[model samples]
Target: PKTVLLLFASGKLVCTGAKSEEMVYESIVKIHGVLEDYDLLFKDE
Candidate 1:
């Protein structure tokens, strides 16, 4: 099953439908990695 992520304009996110907590973290990490690969992640100085 695929997880669902709900992102808010307030910079808050909710990950749901995951089988376990680890799955949630993994999903987030994967997403972050992809964003990084595409240079879509914001960097703060």
Candidate 2:
């Protein structure tokens, strides 16, 4: 199943319909990592 993740420009990350904390955390970390790889993660601007 594909997890639904929402990334906002306001620095809010939303993980929806995850059955467990591990799932949510994993999704968040994975997305965060990919974004970081592309230098698209949040910045302190």
Candidate 3:
């Protein structure tokens, strides 16, 4: 129940072995924070 590829809308993917949905969401939030901290976020829709 680990090591899988997550496909996204932009043809991007994230490989992870997260055990639970909460952990997955937490990882996503952490990555988002890192991107925001570096100003690497989209400006508009």
Tens-place lDDT per residue, model 2, 1-45, is: 258988777888788989888888888888878888999855596
> Which regions in candidate 1 have their CA more than 4 angstroms from the true location?
none
Which regions of candidate 2 are displaced past 4 Å? none
TM-score of decoy 1: 0.68
Candidate 3: stretches off by over 4 Å: 1-15
lDDT of 3 by residue, 1-45 (tens): 334556576747585888888777777777778778999776556
Best by TM-score: 2
Task: Write one digit per residue (lDDT tens) for candidate 1, span 9-36.
Answer: 6657899999999999988988778778
| TM-score attained by model 2 | 0.77
Q: Going through the candidates in order, what is the number of backbone clashes in each?
A: 0, 0, 0
RMSD of 3: 4.3
lDDT of each: 0.81, 0.81, 0.70
RMSD of each: 2.0, 1.7, 4.3
